[model samples]
Target: MVSSSSDPLATRHSTVSRENVREEDALKVLSAYLADDMRACNQAIIDRMQSSVPLIPQLGAHLVAAGGKRLRPLLTLASARLCGYQPSAEQQRHVGLAACVEFIHTATLLHDDVVDESTLRRGMASANALFGNKSSVLVGDFLFARSFQLMTADGSLKVMAILSEASATIAEGEVLQMSTQNDLSTPIERYLEVIHGKTAALFAAACRVGAVVAEQSEKEELALEAYGTNLGMAFQLVDDALDYAADQQVLGKTIGDDLREGKITLPVLAAYDAGTEEERVFWKRVIEDNEQTDADLPRALDIIARTDAIKTTLKRAERYAHKAAEALEVFPDSELKALLVKTVLYTVNRVN
Candidate 1:
C-alpha cells in the first residue's frame, strides 16, 4: 500500500527517519533487494495453487491479486539471503519454502475472514464474503494441504516439524481468541499470547526455514527466528492500534471492526483500565455484554482519545520493533541486513 507520498510509511504526525535506507517504500525496497527471488517464489505460488477444481485457483488468485505486502514470504527470502543461501539450478528449495510460508499465511487469512465474518480484505471483498464461508473454509483447508505437499517435497524433517507445529499453534491462537471474545477482563498477557501464536508463530517458522534451507548454523537460525518473532509482534500491535485510529480508506477495514465484533485489543483494555466508574460500566455493556449502539463507537473513540490508548499501544509496538532490530545484530553489515533493519522500522512506522 505504498502511496504517492515520498515517505510511504509516514503517519499523520511525522515521517520515519530514513538515514540508512528508505525502506518506507516497501514494494520498491522489496523489488530492489529480492526481485528475482520474489518472482520465483510468486511463480511457485501460482504453480502450486493450481487445481483441477476451478474454484480453488479462482478463489486463491483473487486474494493473491489483491496485492498484499507479501511480507511473510519476503521474510523467507530475506532470511535466506542473510544466511548466504545461493540458489543452484538444480535446487531452489528457498523458493518452494517461501511459497509454503505464503500458503500457510493465506490459509490462515481465509479462515480468519470467515471467523471474523469480515466483508473486506485489502479493501476488496473478502474470499468468504464473495465465495461463501463453506468455500472459503474448504479452500483454506486445501491451501493447508498444499503447504504440506510443498514441505514434504523439500524433504526436511526439521522444516516440516517446524511449520506443522506453527500451524497447530495458529489454530490454537484462533480458538483462544474466540474464547476471549466479549470478555473485557481478558488479561494483557493473554492477548499477547494469542498474537504470539496466531501471527508471530508463522513468522518465526518462515524465518527459521530460510536458515534451514541455507544449511546455516543454529545460531543464525535462532537469530532470524527471534527477529521475525519480534517484528510480527510489532506488526500486529500496530494493526490493533490502526483498528482504533486509521483512516478507513487507508486501513481498508472499518476503524472499529474489533469493537463491533466484541474483540478486545489493547486500546479497549487501556480505556477500560483507565476510565471512570461510569466508563467501566459502558465497557462492560458494550464489550462484555456485546451490547452496542451506533453511538457507542464514538464514545469508545472519545475514551480512547482521552486515555491515549493508541499512543500507548504504538509505544509498545516500538519496543518490539527495537527488539527485532537488536536480533539482527548477529548478521554482518550488508545492504540486505540494513534493509532488514529498515523492515523492522517500517513495521512500527507504517500508517497502513
Candidate 2:
C-alpha cells in the first residue's frame, strides 16, 4: 500500500517543503553568488585538461562541452563560502582544487561508459561511443593524471590525501558494482556501500576539502562532509529511480537502461521484495539470466507500479534529502547555507 503522506511519488501533485525550491533557481543563485570563483575554476579546468597529445585535448573537450550540472565542483566552491572563506590566494586554491574535483569526476564518467558499454551520455554520444573504448580509456587516464597535477600544485598534503583517497575509493566502488551487477540477490546494505564509494565519497571529499582550505574547525568540516554525503545519497537514489520512471528526453539516457544492463537498483529491489513467486521468477529470468524481450520493460514497469516500489524508493530518497538539510544546522544561517539547503530539495525534485 502506498502511503501518500510518506511517499513522495504518491504525493507528486502536492506542494511539500522539498518541492518548494526549483533546481534552476537554486543554481542561478549559487552561480551568481560564486561568479568570480566559478570563472576562475572554469579557466583552471581548461588549462589543466590541455595536453600535448591532440587526442587527449580533443576527447576531453568533447565530454566537457557535453555539459552537466557541475554539481561536485559547485559543492566544493559553495562549501568554502559557507565556511567563511575569503577572497585571497586561499580562494584561488579553492578554484584550482574545484577544477581538480571536476577532472576526477569527468575521468570517472569516461571510464564508466567503457565499463557499462554505454553509447550515450548527457544526451549525446558517449566518449567511448564517439572515440572508441581505447581512446576513451586512454583519455580518461589523461584526465586522472591532470587531476593529480592540479592537486599537487595546491601543495597541501591534506588536500592531496583527501582527493587521492577519493580517487581510489571511486575505483573500488566501480569494481564492487561490477561484482554486484546481474545478481539480484545483492543486499541493500551492499548497494548503499557501492554508492557511498562511487558517488558519496567524492561529494564528502569535495565539501571536506573546501573546509580544509578555509582552515575551518573540525566540527565545520565534518558538518559539511555530512551535508555532501547525504545529498549525494539522495542524488543517486533519484537517478536510480529515474532509470525506471523518467522520460528518455528528460533523463538524457534510455529509459530502462538499468534493466537492459542487468543491474538491480532500489526500485527493482523494492518490487522484488514485494513480488509473488511468479514475479520473482520473472525477475530471475530477466535480471539473472539476461533473457529480456522488448516487452519486458513494460511488464517490469507494471510490476513496479503494482507494488509501492517507486514510492518506497522515492521515500528513502526524501529521507536522505532531509538528513542533508539537517546537517546544515551546524552552520550559522546565511545565503549560502539557505541555497545549499535548497539545492538538496532541487536534486530530489529532478523527477517531478
Candidate 3:
C-alpha cells in the first residue's frame, strides 16, 4: 500500500511499494548487494587478464575503481532475483557473466575516450589522458578479448549470441555517431537510432540475458527486454539533459563539452527544430563550422532556453521511465522487483 506522502507515479503506477521512502530503502538494499557482486566481478576480470604489463592492469583498475553506478550488473542480478529465481551458490556463474558485461562496457569507455579525446571521466583524468591514446586503445582491446573468453566459459550459446550481437551493434553505433558528428542537418530520428545502438542495445541485452540466466518464460523475457530498452533510452536522455543543465564542476566535464565535441544531442535537436531561420543559420556556422569563434555558446544556450527543449526532453524521458516500470507488472511483488522499478525512476530523474 502507498503512503499518503508518496508520489502517484511511484505508487499508483508500480506493482511494488507506493512509498518513496520505502523505494529509497529498497534502492539502498539493492545498491549494497550490487556493490558486493560488482567487487567480485572486478576481481574475476583482473585475475583472468593476468597481464605481464603492470600498467595494463593498473589502468584498467583505475577506470573500474572510479565506479559509476554499476547499473548494468545491478539490472542483471536484480532481474534474476525478482523473477522468482532464488539465487544459489551457482550465482557466481551469473556474477561472472555480469562481470563480462561490465568489462565490455569499460572497454568501450576506454576506446570512447581515445576516440573523443576526452580528458576527464567520473571526476578523474580519463585513461587516454593519463596513459596516452595508444595504451588506452590496446588495454581496451585486451579487456574486450578477455570479456569474450569469460563469456565462452558460461557454455550458454544464447548468452554468447546476445553479447556478441550487442558488441557488433555498439561498434556500428559508434561509427554512426562518428558519421553524424558536426552535421547540423542530422535528423532526430537518426540520433535516436544511433543512441539505441550505442547505449540501449547493451542495456536491453543485459536485462534479457538475466531472464535467460534465470530461465524465465518467454513472455517475461520480452517484457524485461522492453523494460531495459526504455530504461536505457531514458537514462541516455537524462545524461544528455545534464550535459546542458549541469554545471561543469558537478558534471566533471566542461559545460559545453558535447558542443565542443560537435555532438548534437536532444536539447540541440529540439532547439534547432524550434529555432527561426536566422537561429538555424547561426547554429550551422557555430555548431557545424570549425572556424567559428566561441561567441556562439551564449546564443546556443539562449535558444535552448527559449525553446524549452530541456523540459520537453525531460517529459519524454519520464514517459519512458513509466514504460519501464509498467513492464515489471508481469512479475510478482518482491524486493528485487521493487529495486528494478526504482532503478528506472532514479535513472530518469537523477541530476547526475
Candidate 4:
C-alpha cells in the first residue's frame, strides 16, 4: 500500500489535496490538454456547420468561441490516445468525433438555459438572455440536427447508437428533473437516475465514441465507457455539492441558485432527510411553498451543516472517483492514462 495519505490521487481528498497537487496545477493540466485539442475541434465544428441561415452560423460560432472546459472532447482524445490510436494513421478522425460530442453538449446547454430561464452561463450572459428564447431554442435545434449529420458522416453505427441514445437519455433526464423541481419527496435514487441520464450518459458516450472511431478492442471500449460514466457522475455530484458549499464569486453564479430555482439537489435532500420536524417544515415553506425569507438560506445552510450532507455527498463522489480509476486498469499504464485518472480525482475533489 502506497498509503493513501501520501497519494492525493488515491485518497478521497474532497476538500483539499493531501499531496502537493494543488487545484491550480490540476486545472493547468486540463487547460493545456483542452487548448491543444480545441483548435481541431473548433475547425471541425465550423466546417460542418456552415449554413444558409446566417444566424445559425453566427450563434454556433459564438457559442463555440465562448470558452468552456471542453471536458468531453478532451476525454475522447485522451481515450483514443490511451487506447493506442495513432493520429498519423487515423489523420484526425478522433478529433472530428470529439468535436461532434462538444457540439451536442453545447446545443443542450443552449436549450437548457431557455428551458430553465437562466440568465448567465459560462460566466457570461446566456444566449437565451441576449437573443430571445425563440432564437436560442431554434439555434439549439439546429445544432442538434447538425450534430447528428456529423455523427452519421463518421460512418460508425456504434458511435451513432451511443450518441443517439445519450441524446434521448438527456432529454428524458431533463424532463424527469423538471418533474421533481420543488417536490420534496423526490428520492435520492431518482435524483441519481436523473444525473446519470442527463450528464453521465453523454460523458460515457464521448469516450465510447472515441474507442469506436479508433476501432479499439471491445474490452478497451468498455473500459473507457465505464471510466467516462463514473467520472461524469462524480463530477455532477461535486457540482451539486458546490452549489451550496461555495461562494458566489467562486461558483460564478448566485449562491443557492438551486434553492432559488427550487431545484432539490443531493445536499438539500440529505439535509431534509436528516432534519427535525421544524426543519422539515422550514424546507416545505421555503422550497415547496415558494414562501421564504432571506433567513431561509442561512437556516438551510445550518441544516446542511448539521446533517453533514456535504461530507456524505463527497464520500459518494469519492467512491465513483475510485471506480473511474479502476476502469482504466485494463489500459496499459502510460502518461495519458495516469493523467486521465488524475483529472477524474481532481474534478470530483475540487471545491469549485
Give residue 23's lDDT in candidate 2 (0 to 100). 50
Each candidate: what lDDT?
A: 0.87, 0.85, 0.77, 0.80
lDDT of 2 at 39: 84
Candidate 2 weakest ten by summed lDDT: 1-10
The C-alpha stretches of model 2 lying farther than 4 A from their native spots are 1-19, 89-91
The residue-by-residue lDDT of candidate 3 on 1-352, one tens digit each, is: 2223343223223322244443423345576756666667667766865788898878977876787767777777666666655557765666777778887888899999999988888778998998899998999999899889988887789989999998999999999999988887899888888888888888888888888888888998888888988898888887887777766765475666777787978888898889999998887877788446677667777888899878777777888888888998988887667677777766665542
Enumerate residue pairs that collide in model 3.
Answer: none
Ranking by TM-score: 1, 2, 4, 3
Off by over 4 Å in 3: 1-29, 33-36, 86-91
- Candidate 1 per-residue lDDT, tens place, 1-352, comes to 2334554345443223444334456545855689899999999999999999999999978977987888999999989989999989998998999999999999999999999998878889999989999998999999999999999999999999999999999999889989889998899999998888889999899999999989999999999999989999988988998888877886577788999999978888888888999999999999988889999989999999998888888888888988888898998998888788778777777653
User: Candidate 2 has what TM-score?
Assistant: 0.94
Question: What digit string (tens of lDDT, one per residue) describes model 4 on residues 1-352?
Answer: 0112332223233353356454334534654655656677778878877889898888777786677778888888878777777666456778878888888898889988988888777667788888889989898888888889878777788888999999999999889989999999999999999889888999999998778877888998899999999988988998889878876664465567788778878998999998899999989988899886888788888899899998888878888888998999998887677678778767876663
Using TM-score as the yardstick, the better of models 2 and 4 is 2
Q: Write down the worst ten-residue block by lDDT for model 4.
A: 1-10
Model 4 TM-score on a 0 to 1 scale: 0.91
- Model 4 CA RMSD to the hidden true structure, in angstroms: 4.1
- How well does each candidate superpose onto the true structure, as a TM-score? 0.95, 0.94, 0.89, 0.91
Candidate 2 lDDT tens digits, 1-352? 1112322232243222735334535655677678888888888888887878888878878877997878899999999888888857544888988999999999999999998998778889898988999998888888899899988998899999989999999999888988989888999998888888889899999999999989998998899889988998888988888888887875577788899998868988999999999999999999999999999999999999899788888788888888999999998898789889878876777665
* Alpha-carbon runs more than 4 Å astray in model 1: 1-9, 12-23
